[model samples]
Target chain A: MSEDKFDAIVVGGGLAGTVAAYLMANAGLEVVLIERGNFPGSKNMTGGRLYTHSIEKIIPGFTAEAPLERKITRECVTMLTDDSAVGLDYRSTRLGKQGSDSYSVLTSVLDQWLADKAEEAGAQIIAGISIENLIVREGRVCGVIAGDDELEANVTILADGANSLLAQKIGMRAEFKPSQVAVGVKELIRLPASVIEDRFCSSDGEGTASLFVGSPTAGSIGGGFLYTNKESVSLGIVATLSTLVEGNRSAPAMLEALKRHHAVAPLIKNGKLLEYSGHIVLEGGYDMIPKLIGDGVLVVGDGAGFCMNLGYAVRGMDLAIASAECAAKAVIEASGQGDFSAESLAVYRTLLEQGFVLKDMKTYRRFPHFMDSTPRLFDEYPRLAADTMEEMFVVDGRPSIPLRKAVMPHLKRIGIGTLIKDVRKGLGSL
Target chain B: MMEYVDVDEKLAVDKFYVDEDNAHIVLRELGPGDMMQFHTLELACPAGLYECLPDGTVRFDYAGCLECGTCRILCGTTILEKWEFPRGTFGVEYRYG
Candidate 1:
């Protein structure tokens, strides 16, 4: 019965937890991963894209056997202003290249695939249980209390999703602020695979990852996104929670409005809505990162607020995977040294600093702040972009004007100083 | 509330453990003289299952709930006191997720 106490006990069976468990189990450690749902991915949610660079670092040939939706080789960023739309569409064969490319994934299947990988590597998965609290002794977390069972471990990892309750109960995480988190609501619309291909202009098994700003949130400080799966599309909006209630715009209403918008309706015109899923997203970058290591305990993935939403793209799964790998490495090293002290487990932070996970997050730390303060980026800028495009293309039986002459006033409305300042700031942050 | 998007047939299958009388969730059941401050209940529901009755009671067809928790939050279930994830292996199983 003493052997029941595993080397490591992982709470939450999402991508981060599963990845960490897999890596640690692969390192020949006894790992038990617990999930509240019947399966790992059952409770996971994503806006539908996975940047594969980090995953490749772990499993070199993961995509060969992984359950993936599509290789997102084509991308679009659209700015919508009520009746107008300005789109920037770019496709490259290079995006389809092996290492640097990304793909759209349904978390339901993807999470299970990853958890299965960990199981294959000897991680024991305890499903259908929700851990209520951490078992702390002598100021160190040694296990978790789930229902009537107290499963012990040398080290316990919190890989639960954003704003983890267990982490908060242990005084490791803060009560999430509405300003720091965004509520994302997504709908899966099923279309014929060929229809999706033709509509998004991807003929050869490639897909589109498109984002929308402005009217999706009714010009609030949030945006909408669309990612094409093989036979369906994941379309949704993520609004800063701070702006929801006072602004009188609920997330579901915003989604309803988004689906009915003329600019967006055609994208999923004849499709069937497969699912409606919503989750809170952490938009807080570096400043929001909690104290990651504690005595005999560590936190990884969303529990540590490792997601980055840079407006153009949102990345968490890869960061979660990458950070979990680091956490697993730190845990493995600490256990081998027979030390799980907070001082010893601090190596996890070092691993993150050494890896691209924390480094990339630090780079974009200022971006979320920029997003929060700049209302024009969501409202004025998108309209300006759409209006500028409308002016450029519309031939109203008037004499053609020089391109600069036509576009200058729109730029002038948003002063040249503002544009330059924003450009410089954007470049600096990204 | 109004027809916006056509939901999949799978949502019609009920997966939640709900007690109608003791729902624990709070929603504004409009009265005869009350002007709807906002159609919040209708807006939060994506599957269009909520119907306002003549006596101001709401007929919410929770069977079609997607469990998105949008309405759960908007309806004043702070910290999700009333909402719980449907039991293991129940609820909408996203084939595509």
Candidate 2:
């Protein structure tokens, strides 16, 4: 018997929505998960890493079954300036532990798996349909309109995405500023598994996550990332829409420049191109979070802006999964009271406040501002690092200067005060 | 031996703009609104899905688009200007993604 009505309607079959549906349905509430893609992941993309701490709590030991790409055991951060690159590398066996390590999986693969889990948990999964409108009556969301179908629910979860028009349609989220978002352009380059492992200096199944600052974005506010997969590498650049536009560099052009970079080209020197995707990522942290709760409705994932870019690390998947858990728990508690008003749904905020989702965002609240305001870190700093390293290594026997004497001129050019001030600001923010 | 990424192979797999009508059709009907608003979008379109007409009306070719979401976001008409995943298992299927 298809009841046509559900306890909750979860929009967007990505990690947050599917996990929320999975949990709520497991808790004995009827759930319907909706996705516009033909399948769960057809429309999605990412930097391709999922930090699994949160997901492990809900679906324990799930990694044994998930389509994981590689276990990241080596971390590399490269500062590039065309012909030169200065890198910091760290390798540790500690990163390979289950429930703590992160892996790179395409969203198309991961989201489909999550949706299947929700479906297996008795939540109805609906694909190949876009929710055209929210069914609101008397200031409360009650159902959704998809094409000719109108399905009713007691509560609605809007986890659609960063440019979620559905959240804005109900006046639940406001128009975001350009500075509040970034446009990420990505290319998945396919190399052999052995070639990938050898190039990244990783063991057979292990992989590396490389982040590039400076030349990737043509000295823009954003940076580039590369994560090794089983037989390919995920490489891309994320630039603030404002900066990319003002800097007169297309996101595609920036990605091309990054691929041609002397330090980046050799890694995938003979690989075939696999896929390309562009996504609008939420850049603004705590400050950009819109109204999270409303009558019979709650927002999660990128719609709620749960992503954080803290220079060294860019995280969204774990945060998405975490938000899903909190949202599910909140919905369950609300259903227990038989109340679906804003007052009842406020439990979502409380759970986020007590969890890592909000805590991490609050900690990095000042970092985005620092990154945006400090342009020198992108332009001058990478060149200085590369130049200083080159000066130290060159021994032409033509009167070699002392180490400090060699580096002082470059430091003096940017001034010691600016470097000191930037360090202080970076420390204070991070 | 090429020093760059083969985006054409990627473009071959990924689908293009989807909506009630072609994106450029909707944008044209909505009017460019402002040329400056179209600048970022015009430059950022990786698939080169668009072109400008003689008098400055932007002409769009939806074939081989990477569907990067830039034109939709950078458009003054906003994301409402019709860009979606091609219907039902029709877009890029990643081999290693």
Candidate 3:
């Protein structure tokens, strides 16, 4: 609670803020990180997996010390109907290889660990304080005004998350559109580690990541996800806000349905519900990125919409980490030059563009639009898979039919032309 | 209609360190037919705090709020008078976020 100015003030103690503070403070810059929650990740929720590539660069071999739940060795994508599920389950050693591996995480623990790392690197960590507004003087961002305290800094970073009111206050970002964001509700179900290993068919410290489409969302423009923790399971449903507003089913109800699904219920049987949390996800891909650099200020993480929801995978934390690295590099360079103007802060954008943060985003810029336009992926495709599977697997005392003939009706139902068009667009978007 | 999981029971299982004096979320006065627009909150709020009464009104409780900000985005300035994170350390703290 010092009135003195610091070199940099980082807002929101999520992944982005902590990483930026860690890097800046490690470079001997006086940095302060302000967190609204009692702790860094207390108010955070995720579908629960982090791609290790971005973070490995920041702290090499971080898996040894990080509070990661389990290394994901099995990947699944199940197209689920009410009573049927068609899934592709891939279990391979390649998935657990170093530098490419991912782990299921509880951010409440993971973010706190990272925040501690930032503090150990000599950053002033302040928790349990909401930043009311930015202290913008003469059109140049000075720092933040939290309650009665006005903390000044030569540079300010907004890592406040998807619903950043402070960034909106300074017009650095705009309010999220219902289409650009999604609502995710989750339940952490606790079970014995041995039970989880037996249920998910994994060995010790190994886990499975599963995604479901169709009935879990009641065939909406979203899906369901489940990640195996060491002694618990992270199960949840995510639906686009626009569709949730229009649909009759609530997110919690969808989650409950997912928990009750014939294929999913058996997986979490006898487990106790440990926690229930909900969050807004930035799913608009690259198109949703708002202004990242302004006079004496920078925006990172979900605040800048650095998230992507590919049908097979959802990524935000890694992008947040990468973006924070870029911002920190830019800030250190700016500090050396003694310039905090918008022009100098523009280096953050260039760094992101040159790195995986913006490159990957730009590569998949058309994805969100594709997912929005393609309704059949959620509804018709799952039903088609179920029907196709029933035709092939269900043995009845009837005349034998050709395999192609058995699947022809389902294909005709979805129309071959429409399927081809969707395939082409999906591939092109990717 | 699909059966929804009992939200109250689900919320009861979670933790909320409530700040009784402050209601972080407040509703604006409703005009004619404004209640219809609020039915969306019933669908969006994961906590199930926003309830549309049969008598053409809405009932809300901030105690169980997950602070996901869905209602804030969906309603915006139209239906909400004020929506801020309950002063730090006073709202829902996810034990395993």
Candidate 4:
């Protein structure tokens, strides 16, 4: 046991933990961060792209020095059937502008950079040590216990990732329901920088992000994502655990099928597989947020279920940054008053509620339900799009009719009433 | 007709630093109908570490685990006797995650 009690102890050295350590240590507080991985990101994985809006507020012009892959200048959404694809590709300079910018990131490099920033700010980082238990005296968390060592602190922050067993151990959160989370399996495929740019239709230092519906998950309640990196591409599929458990396709099989799909095979024709990874992402939205603040304790990042998936955009890093900021602010305030009680720490929730973290989550609260209930979005819609596209483009000896007349039969196959109902529910949820 | 790669071939590209001292995951003894329950792991484990054997049993190797926690979240304590991440500096490391 250490007799010297630090001001704050952060468990798990990922995005949220490192950010909190950086903030508190920068404010001249005694902070220590513990990581179970050999380094910061050895245990992390993502789809994954980072929205720069929140991180920009933390480190202005971060893209200048950060280990970022590429600025996303092109956006694509493709509806794919087994043999056909209908895509909407949008490219504009507006996307690369300051606040709206995003980048595809590989966390192994990004998280190490963040840990360096926190260390530079005077936070002591202890790596390769798993926290075995929380030191709770009279219902208040005072520090953490790792094996035979007990490190004491005035406040403890749990920034552990998606499967936060520590929070559940303390009764602060419940076990994950299968429907509340999704599994993402990814492959990082290597290609030459020039080859990637030529294939994705991008200039140097810029890339594209594409999302797929239909054939990727084989009619499951999930989708596929692809992000172009400097010399590689991140491609994966995410399906809800509930749906995955009930389905016949294994996650690895789904990824294999996605790679072999005609719509995707050409993009990585000669590429070599660099790394394959898997992770669980919280998709339960606002309703899944657990008890965040307690006496001398706080939860941030995926531990608190701070991730959102809006069909077109998937965000977790931004929300992790914002939540860490709010928690840091509240901790800094509490440290000044020497009051680390639950009442004093309640400011963390207040700050999150007032900021975009909670506001944006609230706006899209029903989206997960909307997706889970609508099966046709993954099945019929792609078939309909593919059939309609074939009607107009596949030229046989037959004369083509008017565009509406040609498309109406395909629409009728899905029933106008069902289509209208789905649209209404989808619009209402969004 | 597209041919798919085997799960082992897909996982071959990944790297894992194993913990020799610890068996991070273990399966409980199977009773009647337990094999079917264990078979779900064969369908859901991203690394395909679990296999239902011909003798009405399941086999699992934790060496190549991605530590994604899908098995833990799905099977809970039912089929798994013990499950935790490999102690520090061990388990699968994602170089390009």
Best by lDDT: 3
Interface RMSD (Å), every candidate:
4.3, 4.8, 1.4, 3.0
TM-score for each predicted model, relative to the true structure: 0.88, 0.93, 0.98, 0.97
Summarize candidate 3's per-residue lDDT along A229-318 as a digit string, tens digits: 988999999999888778788788889888899999999999999998888988998888888998889999989999988899889999
- Runs of candidate 4 with Cα error greater than 4 angstroms are A399-406, B1-5, B54-56
Q: Model 2 segments beyond 4 Å from truth?
A: A1-3, B1-9, B15-25, B29-33, B51-57, B63-68, B78-97
Cα misplacement distance, residue A264 of candidate 3 (Å) = 0.3
| Predicted model with the maximum DockQ | 3
Where does candidate 4 clash, by residue pair? none
Clashing pairs in 3: none
Could you tell me how far off, in angstroms, the CA of residue B61 lies in candidate 4 after the best superposition?
0.3
Q: In angstroms, how far off is A376's CA in candidate 1?
A: 0.6
In the range A132-188, model 2's lDDT, one tens digit per residue, is 689999999998887567888889999787767788889977776767788888888
lDDT agreement with native, every candidate: 0.79, 0.81, 0.90, 0.88
Kindly list the per-residue Cα lDDT of model 4 for residues A282-401, writing each as its tens digit: 999999999999899999999999999988889999999899999999999999999999999999999999999999999999998999899899889999999988888898988768
Kindly report which residue stretches of model 1 are placed more than 4 angstroms away from their true locations once superposed: A1-3, A399-409, B1-95
- Error (Å) of candidate 4 at residue A98 is 1.2
- Native-contact recovery for every candidate? 0.22, 0.32, 0.77, 0.72
Give lDDT: candidate 4, residue A392. Answer: 83
| DockQ for each model | 0.25, 0.34, 0.74, 0.60
